[model samples]
Target: MSVTGLPSASGLPDLRQVTPVDEVGVNERVARFQTRSIKKESKIEALKMILSMIDLTTLEGQDTPGKVRQLCQKAIHLHDSMPGLPHVAAVCVYPTMVGVARKALGDCDINVASVATAFPSGMSSRKIKLEETRTAVAEGADEIDMVISRGAFLQGDYGFVFDEIAAVKEACGDAHLKVILETGELGTLDLVRRASVLAMHAGADFIKTSTGKIQPAATMPVTFVMLKAIKSFYFETGRMIGMKPAGGISGAKLAVHYLVMLRETLGNAWMTPEWFRFGASSLANDVLMQLQKQATGVYQSADYFSKD
Candidate 1:
């Protein structure tokens, strides 16, 4: 079967042999945290703290080639327009658009990210997935955002999911790989945690939530669970993986909350774009709005900030 197409179980090796971590240990710990106490005030405080740390800017899914080119121009303009303007961590786009972003961003230090491996639905064969990742990297994508095999993962086929991620990582070469858990479909917090651990063990450099294709994406509870997983994984492996909570993460307050969780859970190490990012298109406007509020002490209308 082609890597881009789905593989039947009979045609592939059992993934259990390649997995590195103890599944049971991960599952148990994740379950235990489900009932743990989380103070409302503490949560709010965490959000506020992280918001302060954020570059508070992002650009996603520019769509057309011309539009992406324009977005890149805007980024350059923003770099010069705003005083103390912190550069966005990366510009995210569809895999096919990687080249456009690369050219648009030029020699700028900002990263160009692409979603690959049958993103939004990881039902394709491993061969196609690997090629997609390789192709994206070859096209100058500094980072790859690939989705996990949610169907197999939900069915408890942990080994299949594990192997897929490992193969994709191998294909990524030097580019950073961000594995999207699609946490919205993972159902329970325990499952989200397990998926996070599984991705990390499979050599994921970052674990992300959602493709923005499903509902209830990137919620506080879901992000909290993933962050805890990151902390635990660090304890076990001594490697600090990145975290990205995407999908419907619009508005400054909500974005700040995500940052809050990252800071409180992972500390200062994760505040940078290297360790954290917001995968959003509309979020930039919200962040700008909030910044305006901070600067002028007044809320601004969306119309004031251009959506392009």
Candidate 2:
């Protein structure tokens, strides 16, 4: 109920006081971000930063140990010819594949992230969601990507949604939790802003945009609204929060625009992979291709990069 959108004494944000989003203002700001130009040197550096911030994901029904290991290898040795390219932020997979990815990543700094809580749908019971989270963390998952129950949230059961996130965060123990808002299904920018505030107040280390499973995923305007929400939350609580915009962001140019938006909105403190990430499946390869172009002055064939 505080003016800054911080949690009330009862530990839940007052949804009534959550700021309403300005869609027109957000759209105009996003358009300006796209128009800002970066010099070639800055562009190359931005590409490298993008590569490091990506969470190379493979959340598929057909995911197998072999396939997961191959993806891990790609994460470790992303374009060996480049020599100094940084590995991705993490490898995201189903909870069953978390151990496989962990063992494959070896001692490298790359994290093993698992999508739990009946991922993509989030239609299971709270007990099941908590147990799944514990299992993934026990199996060596460093990060847990949990989807919020949009149906409950949309039905005005904000307290239920808040409690679920807090319970899941406790189950995660040492693992960081990334709460996916799935903005596409939320229906409006105001709801997206409200959900972002709720997630952060309920113990989410990061507030994510989508599951990469639906249309209108991770649009510039949606991300802009979330970033602004994060700014307000930090001003109130003096605690930093991370942001991740998943799905539909494949090209290096669009990714750069996002970075520009982040820097301009949140300043330099949040410019690292630890504070921001991209939950993507193919974004790594596209960034590699772009980096290669920057290095060689000509685009390399898409086949040059692995599609794992």
Candidate 3:
């Protein structure tokens, strides 16, 4: 069902159908955002805002209870040496580590987000996916980051994708759902745009760009395409769908550039942490280094900030 309460069979566009994206035009438009210069004061503010919008993520198969706990601690206290720093929006972990994150968090302002739907690869049955979502929420996940079945989607099964998202939305209960499109695997800008619309119509609170697993993840041009989709969706439905561009974003300069693109593209209304997020494991440290550089007038080493 869509936000306007329309049935998928009646309202959704078929996956195989799409208007071709102007690749050169999108590339040129995204390049312009990088040229807009931000002053020092504004840069500092943007850096902090970027910090607050990050989903400090560790989705590795080797992730342990201690690592999740450590990440949760980092989420709570991001470089205590720098006072007045806001924590990252959330600490995202695998479903199995949500309990450790919850216990470690212990009622902080930060949220605990867990990835389900077999994550990274949505190759499982609907029964297992729903169970994964429910179990994550029951284990104290404040937010659920669910992956879409790209295989089903690419196989020309748009209904399967819509139904899977709707079912996951139902299983989320109170937890907000951030649907990962993994646009890198989607093969084209048209597909990325269509997937964004499809996810939002199916009840995603946020449409994430990637799971950070695929190569060439979360590029500026790809993010530009999705933001355009989001802007159009908001215009038509009067419903603000959040956007998260995970992976391949590491430097402070690039992070601030993303803010520039986001603010200019969606305006100030969509600039809050509620509507934006960065799902990266190493970005926090880089942001911290930039903050320290701004404060002390010198470049700082990675050792200064705690490792991710």
Candidate 4:
């Protein structure tokens, strides 16, 4: 509500007034982004750019102190063999592991991003969610990725979802807040766009596509819908917002396609890591391989790239 695109009085945006998304048009436009041709040098540059914008994430229930530490290490020194490679933008982990990630990253420019608000499921009470976010921030997380209450949003309880996001944003304090919409569960592009509006109005610093738990996560159509909503909001209020397509983005070519979509939809301003990110766990390795191939003129085995 303190952000642009919402009424100053109540802080809750009316879902009824949201523009209806055209699923077909969205698909067509998404296809065009895929078709946009790039020269070899441009693609090499894009691969490096994608690497810099990666939020190297690990949210598995099996995540441990050691696993998070290894991931943190990877974030800092991706591939020493390749000269002048930029580190990843951030590392994402569960809230409990924020301290582990922070300590391992220790003074590195790479940010420590944590998933809070009961994460992948967002099924817990608001009290617990807010406390979890606060705990993550206190533990030195630079960014908090929170999930919206998908069950409530699916039940048409937009008020509950909106208020929950707003409260989580407040709990974040100085940390950036990324509101995950879990578009896979939203069931349609129209609803995805609506949720995008809700999250942005509720003060999300970034609107992520999914938590990477659900199947069909971060599909092109779903991301297109979310991008459209962001465009509409920016046009209406003249304020810039960030986007992160978190799940199922692993291949280098697909990542470049996403950059094309972001550039065409939100313009050059949103192209930076500050505004755009790929919330993927295995994506960094693939990007590194792509860069290696560009340098060596041969395909690479995954063994050369470090695993998350």
Candidate 5:
């Protein structure tokens, strides 16, 4: 069933043979996900689950050791006022801050994820990308979130993109590799689908939506297309890959809708943080507010939460 130009052996399916996305169908499907209703108790559980699936990220030019430590503390002690709260899945920071975050998290269950391979832009040489990945892993980063070269993929150099991801995966050693497609720059849903397939075939543990620096980051239609690609790839090759929709998702209801989409598309198997994640730092406060409102039947001020 491999498409002629897809080059599955080389870890890339021919783009011409890749299925063309039906934008209308995808949009219609995503619209339906927003309409599904969750019971009160179920919504409470969903909020907690969302909290645990967050990759609390701080990827900015002004990031410092102190800020990274504060972010780690927030991750470790999320709303200490609450009786019980699940720590986030990971703390995402730049490669230089990987050591800071790793030391700050100590032995907590939360993973330390570093964005390597010229993150956000993916404009550097492959050698530097691989070296950055290795350095992060050596610094105790449990996961590596590498951005794919959108320029290469956009120019139809699928092989280059595939090889780059494979190289990064190899450089990751034992650390999991999450490949960011930066769907915002991908331009079309069809291209997004192609990139998703290309990434998974190249040994990506997870296929991410964006780098959170793009305007149209992590839209439902884009995430939906990526999820479907993951499901299709899993059926083709018995391997389960994870999904992350970073940026632009900051509300509890919308986040819950994403969970609904994930459940319905990939089923309950991909429900955990290992298989899915939200790459938003501000999302945590919104979810916390929602949880408090649900518990006490009233919402709290956003000022109550720390904004690190």
Candidate 6:
């Protein structure tokens, strides 16, 4: 399919090949070594560390205006009320609701993220996709989460995928573009790696996995492949791209495992919110409970966790 009204074959790059990684040998070694000690942290300390990297974006389909506003308020409250209040990196919502989050967040320094480009499916016309991205950015979305056309990518139409991302990047202007590969549907480690490189070359600030709409989203094995791809891309272009594994990640322990993987695969530079993020809604409570457990030496019931 043609992306952004441009012919699929024109202004696109070949996607069958992989980038070389000979120069990153040293960085990879250092990352692997640093991550080796991930198992040493106590459960509570580990949870706190990972919770600090969360984005806490909400994207439920049943979200109403009232609920969206409530989520925004809760996010703001968390930013203020929580002790030592490590604010979530962003508050993600639908494109139409960007204004709600923007109005509620108001100079809070938290990014307002929106999912566009036929999100969750990516099966729309390129014109609509571009307009969607442009509209989201115009609506004050600081970060744009877009899904790749799996049909086109799997059909050997890598060029189509690449141009789509590039066109969306152009629409984003100053907004950060996060390209979601929908790794569950991509179905192979090699495709994940190729898609990662394609997104980076097309100007993606981050390469994400899943729309949180698919089953088996964000597995560690797939994440491992994508992290390696990020490492390889950095070696080639010297541009550090972010990684986000969304969907079904609901507990502090799982988040820490992802953090450990990131620390091991990309080193300390990748540990911060700029380089890594977990897209989750229920994860915060689990992390909080773990934190409470650490403080009191007893596990807290689910009731003790905040429902916001």
What is the C-alpha local distance difference test score of each model? 0.73, 0.92, 0.88, 0.88, 0.93, 0.79
10 residues in a row with least lDDT, candidate 6: 4-13
lDDT of 1 by residue, 146-197 (tens): 9999998877677678788888988999999999999889887767877887
Number of clashing pairs per prediction, in order: 10, 0, 0, 0, 4, 0
Which residue segments of model 1 deviate by more than 4 Å?
A: 1-62, 79-81
lDDT by residue (62-163, candidate 5, tens digit) is 999999999999999889898788989999999999999998999878999999999889999999999999999999999999999999888777788888
Q: State the displacement of the C-alpha of residue 54, model 3, in Å, after optimal TM-score superposition.
A: 0.6
Give candidates' CA RMSD values in order.
6.7, 2.5, 2.8, 2.8, 2.3, 4.6
What is the lDDT for 59 in model 3? 92
lDDT of 2: 0.92
Off by over 4 Å in 6: 1-14, 19-45, 79-82
Better of 2 and 3 by lDDT: 2
Model 4 lDDT per residue over 1-308, tens place: 13433344656787778988877888888889999987698998899899999999998889989999999889998998999898899999998999999999989799999999988899898899999999999999999999998888887777778888888988999999999999888898878988999899889999999989998799888887888888898998787789999889999999999998888888898889999999998888998988898999999999767787
lDDT of 6 at 79: 29
TM-score of candidate 6 to 2 decimals: 0.87
Residue lDDT tens for model 2, 1-308: 12333355648978889888889999999999999897688998898999899999998899899999999999999889888888899999999999999999999999999999999999999999999999999999999999999998888888788889999999999999999999999999999999999999999999999999989899999999999999999999999999999999988889999999999999999999999998888788888888888888997777878775
How well does each candidate superpose onto the true structure, as a TM-score?
Answer: 0.80, 0.97, 0.95, 0.96, 0.97, 0.87
Reference-based TM-score, model 4? 0.96
Q: After superposition, how far is residue 11 of candidate 6 from its true place, in Å?
A: 8.2
Q: Sorted by lDDT, highest first, which candidate order results?
A: 5, 2, 4, 3, 6, 1
Clashing pairs in 1: 3-125, 3-126, 3-127, 3-128, 4-125, 4-128, 5-124, 5-125, 6-125, 46-260
User: Which residues of candidate 5, in runs, are more than 4 Å off?
Assistant: 1-9
Q: 4 or 6, which is superior by lDDT?
A: 4
Which window of ten consecutive residues has the lowest lDDT sum in model 3? 1-10
